[model samples]
Target: MAKKLSIIVVLLALMGATAAAQDAKAVLQAAAKGMGTEALKCITYSGTGGYVGIVGQGYSPGDDWPKVELASFSRTINFDARTMREEQVRRQGNYPSRGGGGIPIQGEQRLINLISGNYAWNLQGTNVNPQPAAAATRQLEIWLDPHGFLKGAMAAKDLVGFERYEGGPSREGGFGEKRNILAYTMGKFRIQGSINNQNEVVRVQTFVPTPLLGDTVEEKTYGGYKQFGGVKFPTNFHHHTNWDHEERPQGYFGVRDGGHNSFGITIANVQPNMCGEAVTVPAAVQNTAVPPVRVESQKLADGVFYLTGGSHHSVAVEFSDFVTVVEAPLDEARSLAVIGEVKKLIPNKRIKYVVNTHHHFDHSGGLRTYVHEGAIPVAHRDLVPYYYYAVMDLAPRTLEPDRLSLYPPDEFQETFVLEGVQNDKYTISDGTRIMDLHLVEGNPHAVGMLMVHLPKEKLLIEADLFNPPAASAPLPTTASAANTSLYNNVQRLKLNVAQIVPIHGRVFPWADFVKIAGSGKTN
Candidate 1:
C-alpha cells in the first residue's frame, strides 16, 4: 500500500509538469507568430545609440558605467547557425570624460565582436583575439534576441509558463502591466522572458557566471515594434549587463541611466533573412580553452610577497598572527589561487583583510573569496553602500556558486565587514609591520582610488595611476594627467619612496617615475 501511494505521487507530479510544458508551448507559438518570426531564421539590425565605455570602471563606487555615443551600431544574427556578429563605432563627443571606460576617446573607436556556436572571439583589425571566457555569455546573448528567445523556448522540452505582474519592486506601491513569463533551461543557463498581451517578447533575462557578481543578471527590454520586411523588429531597446537585484528592478537602475544599464539604441534599419551570410568560426577561437589560474610570487620584503602571473597582481603582507592580501582582481579562481599561494608562502596565518584599491569590477571580482575565508575588506568609505547592496547582500550569485555563495552566513554582518578609509587614510599595523592607505584626490582614474604606502620599506603600491613602462619600453616625453597627479600627491604627502610597485606592471624606482613626472605640475 505504501509503495502504491509513492508511485501515485510521482505520476501526479509528472502530469503537472506535462501540463505546464503544453501551456508553455502554446504561448511560445503564439509569440513567435505574433512577432512574425515563425519562419524567420536570421536577422540583421543597425542603429545609433549611447554605450557604456567601461563595464565596471566608474569614477566612484556604485556609480554608473561611463558613457559614449555610438555613432553606429550594427548586429547580424543567424539563429539557425547559432551565430552573431556586431560592429560598433564609439565616439566620445560632449560626454564628460570623468570615469574610466576607455575614456577620453580621441575621435572614434571601432569594435567588432563575433560569436559562432560555442566559440567567441573579437576582431582587432583582422587579428583574432580569442576570448575563451566570453564563450558562454556570448552564446547566451544569441537567445536574448526577441526571435531567438521564442526559438530557444520552443526547443526546450521542459519549458514552463506563469503569469506575473510586470510591475516594479513592491506589490502595493508598484505599478506595471500584467504579462506572461516563459522560462527554460539551456545547458547551464536558465532563461526567462516576458511576453505582453500583444504576443510580443518585451523582455529577455538570463543569468551568467562571473568572478565578482557570481551569477550576474543580463537582460534586454525591447519596445517600439515596427515592421521592416517579412517580420517585425523592435526599434528601441535597453540592455543591462550587470542587472541590479531583481527585487527592485525599477528603482536602482544606476546613475543617469540606471544602475545596471549598459547601453540603449533606437533602430534605424532592420534586415531579415540574410541566408548566405554566415559567420565562420576561426580555427584559433574554435580551439581556444580557458587557461588555468596561475600565481607566481616574488619576495619583495621579509614578510611581503608580490603575487603575479596574470595581467593583475596582488600584494600579500604577513602579520605575526594574520595575513592581508591587497587587490583581489579577476574572480574567484584568481583569488583562490592567490590565497593558496599566500598560504604556501606563509603557513598557519589566517587572511585578516583584503585591501581593495577601488571598486573596478576586475579588481573587486575576487574580493568575495577572501571574505568567505573570513577576511575583512578594506575599501574606501564611499564604497560601503555599493558593496553592501550590489556585491555582497542583494546581488544573486547562484549561477556558479562561489565559496561565499555556497556557505553564506546567516546574517550579512556576521562575516562581511567592509573596513577602511577613515579621513581618507587608514593604516594596518601589528605594532612592528605597518602599511598606510591613502585616498587619491583629483585623479581622472577613480574617485575612491587608494594608494598603499609601506613607509618602513619605502615602497608605494598603486593601480592604474602610473603603470610603469616595461624595462625596455620608452617613457613618455611628458607625463599624463594621471601620472602627474600621482607625482604631485607623492610630493604633497612627503612620502619617502624608493620603488613604485604597480598592480599592472613590474616595480620601478621612484627616480624613473620622476624623470617623466617630476615637473611637479598639479592636475
Candidate 2:
C-alpha cells in the first residue's frame, strides 16, 4: 500500500509539471499575437492625467495618504532606443494640512524628465542636473510595463516559466478564485504577471531599489482591453509606486501607510513604429558629475561639533567614553563619509548611538550604515515595528550591499525606540554631558518627529521644520503651517534655544527662526 501511494504522488507531480510547461507556451503565444508584439518596433502613448509627488512623505503611521493635484502630465517612451521623456505641470491641493521635503507645488511649475540608457536628467525651468539613480529606476519601469514585458519575455523563453494556483481575490472575481502566474527574473529584480483564462495579462508586479525603505514594490493593473489599429491594448491602466511590501524570508512588511506613489491615465492615443528619436544630453548635464563626499566640521561647544559639507548635515556630540551622532541623511556613501569624519574629530571614542530625527526616506536612508558600525538608532516609539521588521530585517540590499549585509547579525547592537508612554523625552547622559531628544508635539509634517536639545549650549537641532532663508534672500510675508507648528511646539516646550542647526540649510540664530515663523519675540 505504501508503494502504491508513492506511485500516485509521483504521477501527480509529473502531471503538474506538464501542465505548467504547456500553459506557459500557449499563454505567451496568445499574448504575443493579441498584442501585436511581432510587428512592433517602437511605441508611444500620450495622455493628460494627474500625478502625486512623493506621496509617502505626507503620510504618518495609521493615516491615509495625503492628496495633491497635478494640473497636466504627458510621457513619451521609445523601446528600441531605450529612452523616456516626461513633462508635467503640478500644484498643491487642499488636503493633508501640511507638506514637507517635496517639490512645493504652491504655484504652477513645469518639470521635465529625460532618460537614455543608464543616464537620467531633469529640467526644471532653466536648471538642468544629472540623476543617475532616477535613470536606473526608469529602466526598470520601462521593462515592467505589461506589453513591454510580454514582448521581452517572448524573446527570452529560457528565463520565463509559469505556475498554477488556486484563485485569489481579484478585481474581476470576488475571492477564492483560480489564477495563473508568469514569472521571470531580470538582473537582481523579479517580475510576476497575473494572466486570466483568456490569456490576457491582468497585472504585473516587481521590486525597485530605494534609499529609506530598502526594496520598494511597484505594481500595475490593466483592464478595458480594446482594439486599436489592428492591435489589442488596455485602455484603462493604473500604476502604484510603493503600495505593497516585498516578500522576505521572515515575513512581509511595508513602512508606507499603504499609499500609492502615483497613478496612470486612460491612454488617449497610441502610435507605433515612430523611431529615430533619441534624448540629447544638454551641455551642462553632460559636463556635470557626482562630487566626492566632503565633511566640514565646526566646533559649536567643548564636545559638540556641527558636521556639514553637503546639503544635509549631522551633529556629533561626545560623551565621556562614546559619541552620539544626530541625523544620518542620504545613502551609504554620505553616512560612511560622516562616520569617517566623526572618527577623525572625536579621536578614540566609538560612535555608540545615532539619533534619527524622523523616518523620511532622505533623513533616515543612512541609518543602516551606522548600524553596520554597531550604533543603536534612537527614534520615535511609533516606528519600532517598522524599523525592525521593514527597514532592518526584510530589506534586500542585493543591488548595493551595506555594512549590515556584509557582517553577521550579532555584530550590530539592538535598535532603541523612545516610547512616549514611559517618557515623551529621552535623555542620554554620562554624568557630565547630556543630550535630550524630545518629540515635536502637534506637528503636521510627520508623526513621532524628534528634535535634539543641548541645554548647556543653548542649541536646538531639527529638520524640515523651518529652513532659514539665506541672509541675502527675502523672508516670506506669512509663515507656513509646518513652520507655525514647529514654532508653537518650541514655545510650548519652553526650550531656551539661542542658536538653530537645521538639517537642510545653514545654521542660523534662533531669532531668525522666530522672525520667519512670524512670532512677535525671539527666545
TM-score of each: 0.89, 0.86
What C-alpha lDDT do the candidate models reach, one value each? 0.83, 0.73
In terms of TM-score, the best-performing candidate is 1
lDDT of 2 by residue, 139-183 (tens): 767777667778656655454455555345755667753456777
* Candidate of highest lDDT: 1
List where candidate 2 sits over 4 angstroms from the true fold. 1-25, 53-58, 165-180, 243-261, 273-277, 287-289, 394-396, 411-422, 519-523
lDDT of 1 by residue, 205-304 (tens): 9877767656767889998999878687899888887754323233544422224667788998898886546788889887889989989999998998
In model 1, which runs have C-alpha deviations exceeding 4 angstroms?
1-20, 167-174, 244-258, 394-396, 408-412, 519-523
Error of 2 at 246 (Å): 13
Worst 10 residues of 1 by lDDT: 249-258
